[model samples]
Target: MTEINENALAKMREVVPESQIHYLTKAVSRDDKNKLGCEQKNGRNVSADGIFCGGYHPKSFHVAYWGHADLTARLLEADPEWNWEPLSVDDRGLPAFDQNGGLWMRLTVGGVTRLGYGDSQGKTGPNAIKEAIGDGLRNAAMRFGAGLELWSKSDLRSTQETDDAREWLVEAQAAADVPAIREIWQQARAAGADVDTLDKITILAQERMEGGA
Candidate 1:
């Protein structure tokens, strides 16, 4: 079982934005400490659970499954512009985290979920439901204890798309400069977007302010 270090969690929160923070917990399977639906911990052979906390993207609101190696490879193969790494796999070669485990944190900005994966095989089951509940509970706990922002399914982007967008934006902004900013501004102005769109522009501007460009 992985250790849940409160100090590490606190530090993680500090690094992550309060607006992007989310929380979820899941039960691990005993039959497979790493697989879904196998009970293995707490002497009851209950599934091992994890607490996931992070941001939600505006595109694909689901980030957990997108982290899967299979999914990441497919996505990257399809688009070399993607700037994220696949989730690490355990000794069994399964993705480090699956839909059945925990609600992994996903950061999303400008319609993308940052660092996460989605399972394309669609092997969801009991563990999937358990994971969802865990995610909800963890999110509630964080919102109650830390005053972080929380959004419903519809309000946030689907986890998968959101995960991709966030990472791409991060990478793109990293290589951005005054010229890039000018382009973004030009595009936004040309589109005559609403306040929210401009707000995203502002956020991107702030990132540039902090040397993201």
Candidate 2:
């Protein structure tokens, strides 16, 4: 697990629009089926779930681009001039697929290009090709810092303290002994609580103390 930096997330929100982040933030449990029998528009999506679906995808980034027009759609939506070229080619100058049914896609945006690899071997038939192309491009874009927050899953994004943190706050508040509560603040500061966090702790503790009183 990696540490989540508070400032970095705010930066990602600016660089990548929330419209794109929402898809990356989505999660479906193994038994959840609201999306069952529905295919993404244009097959452009790069889902967190693999072709067949099972466990949820990593929540750090858009797990999958949905729809058939995925790679093209993302580029056009962001920068109309964006397009992709196959990094690997056959003798006929066509896009090439490897033995594992993977392809590398090179995406050029505003004249700059990036190469990303895709694997849709798990999928069968024609759509496999489309999926590979989209996934490869998405993977490459992420490398460009397109979705830096995707580097950390949703759980890691929040600045709000955890249940444990809140528990400590509440416990300290309820403590009748001053030294006991002081110890809580000390522990919290050592754990890297920010000024705002300490303020919140004080406020929460006061409310608890007052309520008990």
Q: Which candidate comes out best when scored by TM-score?
A: 2
Error of 1 at 110 (Å): 44
Per-residue alpha-carbon lDDT of model 2 for 1-213, expressed as tens digits? 434443432332335444443343343222223343223431212232223232333211133333434434545655665668888799999899888888978866544566888888589778888778767876777655555455444345343335546666677767776556667766765554434555666676667566664
What lDDT, from 0 to 1, does candidate 1 have? 0.37
Report how far residue 211 has shifted in candidate 1, in Å.
6.7
lDDT per residue as tens, model 1, 59-151: 111222111333233333333333322245569854355545543334222223344333323336766644443343334323322223233
Candidate 2 C-alpha RMSD relative to the actual structure? 16.1
Lowest lDDT block of 10, candidate 1? 57-66
On the 0 to 100 scale, the lDDT of residue 79 in model 2 is 60
- Model 1: what TM-score? 0.19
